[model samples]
Target chain A: MRITELFDNGEFVVTAEVGPPKGISADHVVEEAKTYLSGITAVNVTDNQSSVMRMGSLPACVALKNAGLTPILQLTCRDRNRIALQSELLGAAMLGIDNILCLTGDHTKMGDHPGAKPVFDLDSVSLLHTACQLEKGVDLAGNPLVGEAPKFAKGAVVSPCSDSVDAQLAKMERKVMAGAEYFQTQAVFDSEKFIQFMEKAKQFGKPVQLGVIIPKSAGMAKFMNKNVAGVHVPQWMIDELAADKEKAKAGITGVELAAKVIKECRPYCQGLHIMALGWEAKVPELLKQAGI
Target chain B: MLITELKNKDTILSLVSGKVFIINCHGCKDIHFPEQEAEALQKELAAGGNVTGIFTTDYICNPENLKLRLGYHAEAIAQADMILVFSCGVGVQTVAAAYEDKKVCAACDTYALPGYQGVTPLEHDCKQCGECFLNLTGGICPLTACSKSLVNGQCGGAKDGKCEVDPDMECGWERIMRRLAQVGRLDALKCPVQVRNYATDDEVKSK
Candidate 1:
């Protein structure tokens, strides 16, 4: 079933993202998707996330679809121009891939290949609007296409932890106007902030899936807290994870924390989008513990 | 007005091994221009050999003004083997245009000063993507400020409203958010502006 249907059908939607392999070997990509297929409404395949070179998200999404799991092809504008972007969208439609998540992507300087020139021909907002135009049998310039237009269950991302809620909501309204059927926010660690964000976002009357990251250890949490943007890990949560020196105990605490966030945010959000951050094996465990 | 730092003294000195004349633009009087670089170069050049002349001016970009100045030092400039220009790219180009026979080189490496190309440098830089979103981002240019250059929202590398690439630098979006909130224009961030025209630079260059 399509992700939009899952959201519209009144089932609490659950989505998870999977990073494409950096190399050609993607046998593990499929295996990773299978690990939590039963627990997720759909799986998102990231496109060159963090500006790192990786196996294309398109083929990975195809692989996931073949594995009997719904795949949301993650597309970014950091590497492609409008022509290439539209061509890939048509390709996804041909492959029976119906879901997509639009992102502007990080600059190439942030990746292993800092020398690569970034082609941000279209930002996330523009890309979403372009996708909507392609769905209507026209191009971004409003020119008619020769063939049939593509169809997609379009999705976008938002940052609930932005410094100003009004500004963030304004961006959210643009995404919705651009035809973003749903939203999966950046990793949110604070439930109070997310609840407040939801209160404003709900006025748009769209399904928003809160992002939850399951940090492996206190050190990892601290690293994300200090470095990652749009994410904040409360000192109390860090102290809890750092309470123990045992790695196993830290991992357990991490799960408990993710569960706590999920339980707290579930009341306000339409669903949870679990970002395992390479800890894919723990996603199912988190779902079970959160009683989802 | 942009930042132009002098190249290594030894490296520059080695490039012009004969009689040298220096031309520096004090017109913009930009803080990032390293106002003393021309004098330092003059002193170092004098130590090596005869320093022909130091032509100082405000509008180095004005070809007419530069030509007028060159007329005054025609003899000194004629004797020099190379002319070193200390200014921004526009000034360097103007100086190069004034002399066709002489080897004109930039003694300073020109860079985009943070913010607009105006006199005073701010904490922001605009890539000049053409479609101005400053009205939306509270006058901050996310295209050049954010390490990721994310337009719709902030990246995952922000911590406590600071950029992940540099902890000391406040996140551009965070600053934009705060400013937008203060002005009650936070709603401007909602409507996604049209796709950025990458050809803006090309069009300007062609003109």
Candidate 2:
């Protein structure tokens, strides 16, 4: 089902992130998704996440769809120029891929190949505009397509936990205009801040999914707090994770913490976008623990 | 003004060999020239007897004037094995274009400057992106200042009022929000999404 239609049906949709491997085979990801992501709404295939080289999201999404799972193809502008971006969008459409999440992507400097030339010819907003153009049976140059044009249930990202949110709101407005049907925010750690963001964001009249990253360890939480943008690992969360570490140190250590955050934010958002990052097996347990 | 920061001394010195001709542009009305830094490097190179000579000029981006000044340094430049350019990217480019055969090394890295064109003393920069967003952003140019160059809005990477890309750099959107709030025009941001027109940039347009 299209992500937009899921929201329209008033479903509390849940999606989990899956990165394609560095090599060509999508077998591992497809197997992982089939095993654990059956309960989720869709599989979000990342496009070279963290600027690391990986199997393309287009192929992986196709693989997931063939495996009887929905896929949201994350399309970033970091690697491709405008020409490739437009071409890729059409290619995704031709492959029966409809859901897309447009992003600026992490800078190439953060990737494995820091020296690779970053091609951000179009930013996220412009890319969304370009996508909308393609859906209208034309490209960015106003040139007509060969036959039937592609349509997408487009998504964009936002950072709700930013110190300053006014600028984000302004940008979110632009994303909507540029054809963002839904928004999945950056990793959210503080629920109170997210609630406040939701108050303002609700006016847009679009479904927003809260981004979730389970704090695997206290050190990881601290690292995210220090390095990740719009993500603040409150002292309480860190302390709790550290306490969990003090215990058995096994079987989803962050489930309670994840559940707490999910329970708080679930009321405000339409869904959850859990970025499992190799911990796909834990997502179902987390959802159940959160009483979803 | 084009603000140029000195590259690592050891790295710059490695590229330089034999008797070198130093062309330093005390440019930008000398408002931001790292004169002391440049002089310190020159002293070290001279102590080793590798410096053949030193030539000082301003506004090296001005090609016609720079061509005339090049005549004065021709003898010294001819004797040197390498030419060390202590200026922004524009100055280095001008010198490099003038002397294609001569190996020219840039002693400094230019930061957040517009074309490195050596224009005014003003701190702000405009890349001439054609479509202006200054009105909505309270005079701050997201294209030039924001590390991500996100015209639509601020990214989620800023922390402690600093940019996600560079910790030392101030978050561009934070500055814009402050300015907008200060001017009592914060509501001006309730506008539409900004889609940058790549048509103005020929390089981008071709792609």
Candidate 3:
């Protein structure tokens, strides 16, 4: 089913993300995606999620579709200019990939390879506007096309747990104005803080998907809290995960913590996006625990 | 041949507050005067608004007379707070060199017409860098020709002969193929595609 139709059907939905393999082949990641497909509404395929280059997101999305799952292709403006971006958008639509998550992307400086050149011809806001224009069958210059352009259900990311909530809300407002139909927030751990964000986001009248990151270990949780921008992991959760030394036990604890957050904020959000990273297998249990 | 008043001479002298005698050699005739635009400026100047004096020649047409004209207009320019050029051609360059520190503004958008064959106002299109890959894909530039400018191939929206974005223009690749076929250069279309540089910095620097 089309993602927009699925969204309109209005049940509490579940989605998960699968990072593409670093190499050209999808064999390694496709098997991981299959485990969570039945349990989730759609799976988001990341585009060079970090600064490190990897296999492109398009083929990975094709792999997901071939496995009978809907794929939300995450597009970043860092790599492609306006021309490349529009071309890719049309290609994705033609290839039967509908949902798009537009992102400004991580700066090249922050990626594994720091020396990479960045192409930011249009920022996230402009990209969203371009998507909106294409959906309406018009070019970026406002000229009407001879026929119809493809329709895409565009989504954008927001960081509710940013250092300044007001600044985050302002950016969210701009994204909404630029035609973002849905928002998937940055990794959110603190429910109280996210609830505060929800109160402000409610004005824009769009669905918000709270991001849940499943940390592999206590050290991973600490690493995200300190290094990842807008990800705030409370100390108590870290201590709880730290208590479990066994790797299996730690993974279970991470899923359990995410489930708790999902259950708590389920009333406010449309869904939860479980970012398992390498731990894609645990998402089913996490969803089961949350009773979704 | 044309007589135009220097409206700001008195006010400019008052601002500088001196006995300023200004002579304009370019006179006010050769500057291309669309009757309506000239009338509008005259009304604006007569309403006691800022009006720099007019020029005698269309700057682009009469290049040789520009130096002589600038020599005539130098006094008014030196005395005033600003020197505005309403002419086209070499008159602009002449005045620019003479009044190095004076405020100078052109009422015309700048463009280079072929040689001095008379100004054939060119519309700004995609900047044509020497790197011509349009030959490989067809006559349509994958860079400027394509609605989306897909490098590898046409986007999904390339329906029939029209673009999915704009149905009127033939798809960039389609145009390229047709043009190559027409010129019988289809065999020459087998080069490895090189990415076109659309950098704004190079275009801006050239301008």
TM-score of each: 0.71, 0.74, 0.60
Q: Which regions of candidate 2 fall more than 4 Å away from where they truly are?
A: A246-248, B1-116, B119-122, B130-133, B187-192, B199-207
In candidate 2 chain B, what residue range of length 10 has the lowest lDDT sum?
B113-122
Q: What is the lDDT of residue A69 in candidate 2?
A: 97
lDDT by residue for model 1 (A104-180), tens: 78768788898998887787888889989998999887889877788899998888986555556777787888889
Pick the winner on lDDT between candidates 1 and 2: 2
Judged by DockQ cut-offs, is candidate 3 incorrect, acceptable, medium or high?
A: incorrect
lDDT ranking from best to worst?
2, 1, 3
TM-score of 1: 0.71
In the range A1-292, model 2's lDDT, one tens digit per residue, is 6889989999998999999999988999999999999889998999999999988999999999999999999999889988899999999999999999999888787789988987777888889999999989999889999999888999999999887787788778878878899999888888999999999999999899999987788888899888887889899878877875744155366777888899999989999999987778888888998888
Comparing 2 and 3 on lDDT, the stronger one? 2
lDDT of 2 by residue, B110-189 (tens): 54434445454334455545344554555556777787777666666678788866799998878767766764556656
Candidate 1: residue A125 lDDT (0-100): 83
Which segments of candidate 3 are over 4 A away from where they belong?
Answer: A143-146, A247-250, B1-207
Chain A of model 2, TM-score against the native? 0.98
Best by DockQ: 2
The number of the candidate with the highest lDDT is 2
